[model samples]
Target: MGLRRLDIDRAALLTALTARDEGLLGTWLDLRDGTLRALVEPDDEAFEARLESESDHYVKVPLFTREFRLMAEFVEQVDDDELAVRLDQALAGPSAFRAWEGVLAADPSEQRHWRAHRESALEQWAASWLAGIGLTAPWTDEVPAPEVPALLALVMDGPVRRALGSDAEAHTTYVRACRDLCELLREPFPSRRVRSASRFARGPVVIERSGRDVTIRLRADDEAG
Candidate 1:
């Protein structure tokens, strides 16, 4: 199969990626157009049915942690030692994030730096996640096509049928390979047999879908045109 490169929606992916609230209803990426549609109301049967019928085109977004970066981690990356100390100290109290925000708000330049720093990290993270799923980001260079699994080839493409011409051991191997692929796919993505993508085309990460197509843009990426 030819690798289909999609142009995805940037904002929607970023919204999912940068989400601090773990209490989302659910989110899915429509591969046909790279647009993400969130299921806000759990009982929306029409939307649920659409997702079910068109399951191949949609990938579910996993639960994410807001602790992608710790306050101390960001502080350590700061260029200024004094400011770093202040930032680090700010993490000591009850209103740590507020205190840290107070400091950054007082320093416009550093605040900009912090935002840029965080955004850059997020871009990289999102790009890596997408690339793992055989998608490309505009800023990233030379992403190869996705790897097809053994089960798809054996079951769908009739490789196991060909195994019938060979010895019993060969056919058994093929069956085992398909079983492994099934287990792998059932596993959690990255680790399991499933997972997610965000980046698309030569863009940052805005995801929009029209008809059977998706376009993603990176609105916050300074490097994205």
Candidate 2:
């Protein structure tokens, strides 16, 4: 009878690929049959010892740091300017990875988006790595762009106007815009930045969200008019 060739356990491999911690148990490919075994640090000492002896039946799974690209690409695609800026900050300095996790954890909305992005990247990354090692991916390699939320899309495409005007649709659109705009600026808006923005205003009207507060104010230019 011919040998049974099992497909690789892709989910486990993807987890290993995305691991940033030093204690990760490595993902191993089983030669006996196409499958995987993960050995995390400080656990399963018996398997760890036997791993070297069983090299004929297993090999270290192919690896890459492709998952690290998640934060970089996610920051670029973020629709919220403030959130994008925060993500950029988290991607820098010695504690970047931890900082990024903290930031993502605080914002559940963006965290969900981040997970979707990570999943797509992980799938593509695994599929590519599997291909390099002459294994067929159980899934497609095509990573679709992370979907933009409908409210965020509306905010980005919303018309920039001085007033909501009298139209019912305009009022409806403005309410939605206000809600989404608040999400973009969840913290206090500095007065200095407000002044800077006022200098460039087409009209002296600004709609702003500070924490949970939403306010409409007249700009310096329009204040005197």
Candidate 3:
């Protein structure tokens, strides 16, 4: 299958993965472009149901370390010189974390350089590594349409479900929890800027744009607007 560019909210997705929040497995994303696709493996009802029932701790799959040697064999096949160097280092070591630790301990400057290098090549790495694992999900930063139902399902399963209880009264608790999650993942709209002023200000000071050349004067709460 051809590679598909999938726009994922990295922070939110990573949160679920790190927390072993298996609730997200069957969620779907309705994209801003009007296309709908499973955010994870949405159709895997059996897998998701099993996940909900299981209470085991989640472990990160060691994809890189396990495949390092095999991937190393194909270093010469890589077109990018810098990534090839990274691939070599990764292959020579037991894990990427250890390899990076050694590099940082040896030369702090090299650590910063590696960060920049990794960020620049993330798309390429995702494309290559995901393909190797038989997945076409290349990461992108584009914001997705907020499909509240699926997102709610993702964040409110397992522990949250049990905690809230299965009674009719639980719907209120579920809605409250889902609303909180949605607020956390909500994207800011209409393009605004926030500036911090005094300690007296209780929340974010948002400034929304108006007509062209429009300007607004701001003062502290003690002062007139």
TM-score per candidate, chains pooled: 0.56, 0.51, 0.26
lDDT of each: 0.56, 0.57, 0.37
lDDT of 1: 0.56
**lDDT for each residue of candidate 2 in 72-179, tens digit (9 for 90 to 100):** 988888898998888888887568888888888989999999988888767775665454344556655343333343434443534234443444544444444443
Candidate 2: pairs in clash: 25-39, 25-40, 204-219
Candidate with more favorable, higher TM-score: 1 or 2: 1
lDDT of 3 by residue, 1-225 (tens): 644454555433333222323443322233222122222534576644544464242211211211333344455655668766875786566877576456455555555665555444443333343343333443543323323433334434321213323434344333333333323333211111121111111122211222211112222356532
Candidate 2 global CA lDDT score = 0.57
Candidate 3 colliding pairs: none
Candidate whose TM-score is highest: 1
For candidate 2, the per-residue lDDT at 154 reads 41
Q: What is the lDDT of candidate 3?
A: 0.37
Model 2: C-alpha RMSD to truth? Answer: 20.4
Error at 73, model 1, angstroms: 3.1
Q: Between the candidate structures 1 and 3, which one is better when assessed by TM-score?
A: 1
List candidate 1 segments past 4 Å from native: 1-4, 20-23, 63-70, 142-225
The positional error of residue 113 in candidate 3, measured at the CA in angstroms, is: 1.9
